[model samples]
Target: MKREPSLRERKKLATRAALSRAAWSLMVERGLDAATPEAIAAEVNVSPRTFRNYFASREEAILYSLAQTGPGLLDALRARPVEEPPWDSLTQVLPAFAAAFADQRHIIGSLLRVVDEDPSMRAQHLVTYERIDRQLAELIAERIGAEVRRDLTPRLLAAAAAAVLQTSIEMWARGDRDLALPDLVREGLVEVRAGLPAGAAVRVSSPSPAG
Candidate 1:
């Protein structure tokens, strides 16, 4: 029932993927400043103009692989049995999603570190996640039989799921914990489903007035 990509489309996808990998490697090795459009295009045996045809900027090219997370998560969620509850469906997909990047954990950590250091890269990173969140909201709406625009539940659930994913990955990327990324994702999702019990808060004391 589904149509396959044409030869041209397949070639374009391949070229784009190659560009993404080249950009990621260059950025990791040289940082953003050195990984310019020309450098990235050179790594992929292409012209700077060709890179423009595929991606708008160096940051976009480098973050392209990371952006695939949205499509991967959505596809996995769609594969879940429709009869399952929305929460259960969401909870089940996260571990698989986390596991997909298990071997690339170092790459993810490196990319995130680079993104955090630069304002433009951070902006691109946020933009990538915001797009993912929008797609997720739509999918959640379908699962729960809610209108995307009229109902808040789908949007809220999408935001919560996205937060859990991002937080868990960031913690795992730090390599401070003994558990695997998928385990952290599973635990985080479970905690959210449990209504996120209150924890001790860090309070800041008021400053004394100057004499």
Candidate 2:
């Protein structure tokens, strides 16, 4: 029989989830500037201290909520059968990522709006993207059996991929009409493949940028 999640793990997960929910709700209701950690704690029925225990700051908490979309996408990609190529896995998983945004379009729209309105949020958004790019690079490195380094080749490819993914996400988020996010992701991948040096082997196991 499969063992259940440990009590500690479950509690940690619950606390983080509650904190994320509380932060997002406060952000939507009062805008990011007005949603202080104290206010978020009060909204979540937790003390400010407890809130800090779960998150470093109000901005960090909000960033966590935004970054939560990444892991879900990774999980979907991991779930693809081994027989599938990396590209196929990505194509299959990307729609699921886009579908998530479509599901929470309003919250996403609100977050994007708030970020645009606040310089601090804009900086935080850039940091979040850097963090995501690093994670994607790790995934790519693992797939290609290469180390992530300052070298031009790895860095350039990673940067280009990240740019594509980021642009795609922004387009989908800002569009008046709903976009098929997965399709955009696939198109981006195709572009990446086309632009690579001739005779370069495409590794499907690696993660590509969302822009």
Candidate 3:
């Protein structure tokens, strides 16, 4: 039901995306100052004022590029049949989410520390993730009902799922360069979904203690 953007709008969006991508790549390669707004705009063949119209600063452009990780999730969830279990839909839809990270996994992994070191970037990163969490909660509620918002289930699942994604990325970013993020996410979500069912058949095993 959503209207598509006109060609002019699409061109604007593409330019904005290019500027953000340029800013992100430059900052990652040479640190933030190397990616000044004028420099970023120049990278994309745009004027500084044009860049300013899209983003207030170079930092905002970089963050905007970083936040692209989350956009497809809502659409993925919506594509599932209504009768499908939320957990099943989420788990199935998540593999595509993993694919989105493929091109930038290394870049994002390396910049994890850079983001941590910069207070503004760190603050923006947290805000971006938190906003996505709220958006996911809303989607889950819509899939079921608004009443689920009053109950803790939808919100809790959204939070836990977000945690799984964060943990997988952190693990990947830390050093496991070859680790498959989708597998980690699937395993973690399986555990969460299993834990929710009453009298759930699945159980974890522990070693017996020596006497």
Candidates' C-alpha lDDT: 0.88, 0.71, 0.80
Task: List model 2 lDDT by residue over 1-211, tens digit each.
Answer: 5489999989988888888787877788877766788888887788999988988777778888667766665566556775565555655566556665656655666778878888878888888878766776666555556678743454555566667677777777778436576677667767676774444765567687789
Task: Please identify which of the two predictions, 1 or 2, would achieve the higher lDDT against the true structure.
Answer: 1
Per-model TM-score, in order, reads 0.91, 0.76, 0.83
Model 1, 143-193: lDDT tens digits are: 889998999999998999899888888888878676898999999998888
Q: Per-residue alpha-carbon lDDT of model 3 for 1-211, expressed as tens digits?
A: 8999999999988988999889988988888779998999899988999999999777778888656656678888898999997878889987568757766677877678877788877777787788888888888888887655496878987888888788777777676645677777787688777784644767879989989
State the weakest 10-residue window (summed lDDT) of model 2: 150-159
TM-score comparison, 1 vs 2, better candidate = 1
Model 2 residue 58 CA deviation in Å:
0.9
**Most lDDT-accurate candidate:** 1
- Clashing residue pairs in candidate 3 are none
